[model samples]
Target: MIILYDISCTRHNTAWSPSTWKTRYVLNYKGLSYRTEWVEFADIEALSIKHGFAPSGKRADGSPRYTLPAIYDESTGAKIADSSLIADYLEATYLDTPSLYPHNTRALQAAYEAAVLAHLDAIHQFTAPYLMTKKYFTPKTEEYYRKFREPAFGGKRLEDLLPFGAERVKQWERLKNDIGKIAAWYDKNDRKGSFLLGETPSWADFVAASFLVWLRVIWGEESEEWKDLETWHNGRWKKLFAAVKKYEAMA
Candidate 1:
């Protein structure tokens, strides 16, 4: 089983996009062996072209697929696009260890969106201010925000980076506040479960854990807000940490 991951270089990697972290988690959780290839904002499109995969509408070279996070399977001749789609692919491909869609498929997906997606939003709030002045994709490109993430989703950054105006600043504030809500939900919903899907981990936890990984790293250890937020995220972290440790021992 060969898994090709579409990841970012340290220079271009965004703290948001739970999909990226989720992919890494799934790979580690399943104890699957895979190799990672990092792509820059400028070279992503050319790489996609070489691989014949395009997920976004425009490209770094000015063609299309301004999107990132494209995965290809060399063994199966199948390439996967988007973060959510990639989770489904990982779940289906790794059936023996654990399944993302364990039960109550509808609720699982709903929570995934509500919780995991919320983390993505929070990540945006945490990082967007810094990203506004800095170019994440390609430094040589004229557009700082990249054409793909431009347009601003309801005055947000999904369409494209629109200068991170006052509207975006307010949007960031709203997203930053959302962290409390996510924690409150976890305090209520998580109960005694080791992972998000009761006992076994799910795609929900896979992506959710990434939020914690970035948050802890981004905020550092002194953040009381981060410590408070851990009521929800820490469980997943402990689980994945143990799994990775075990996997390493196996090596």
Candidate 2:
């Protein structure tokens, strides 16, 4: 069994972090049995440090800065961090499961994963402030969320970044264009279905779906943001999301 450490809130009672969503998707896609270890934002750094987990990279001061989505494999007493690395570990360890990178396409898988992450980074510019202001967070987690995000916004308050008027429209347009470009590639690939790889879902599908799941978290599923997105590429986002929606049941 694997124990997945996830960032979660008491209100939602489910995994809330986007990065963790990738791992959850992979675990469920492989049909592996795992349990969640939910942690608040405030405790992640300390908890990770206590478990001898080092940061993905060092800060300017060379201090380790840890984040969530780390897992502890009970069967092997092995612990791992980072979503991409975790995916690699899972793939190599569980050869019997459906392959994330079918047909030895590790390089291609890496390329798709990187592109999805880059798009996610852009999406965060608009989603971050909304996440920061959500009322579902506990007091400590809410405090940590604001403080942790300050550096990303150059010490400006998170609430101050909320887009308005033309700025809001511009951000939505950029997001739509981003989705449109990716959907265009999928459209031309001629998959003939929801998945990028035709009938079978692949790592690329998980990567794309993870971003959609993240968006649903930042805004409710019924939000106008989603409504606008549902109209793009003949509802490609909706289709991509439906392909992965079954995994949510596992969570």
Cα RMSD (Å) between model 1 and the true structure?
Answer: 5.8
What TM-score number comes out for model 1?
Answer: 0.66
Model 2: per-residue lDDT, tens digit, 1-251?
Answer: 99999987866556657788889999999998898888888998888988866577665567777877898988878788888888999999999999888888879988877776666435766677776677657888878878777777777777777778999788778877887777886887664778877888888887777777877877777888777777788888888887778877544
Clashes in predicted model 2: 0
- Candidate 1 lDDT at 82 equals 67
The residue-by-residue lDDT of candidate 1 on 146-189, one tens digit each, is 45455443445532433257875776456555654554454565
**Winner by TM-score:** 2
Worst 10 residues of 1 by lDDT: 242-251
C-alpha RMSD in Å of predicted model 2 compared with the true structure: 1.7
Candidate 2 lands at a TM-score of 0.93
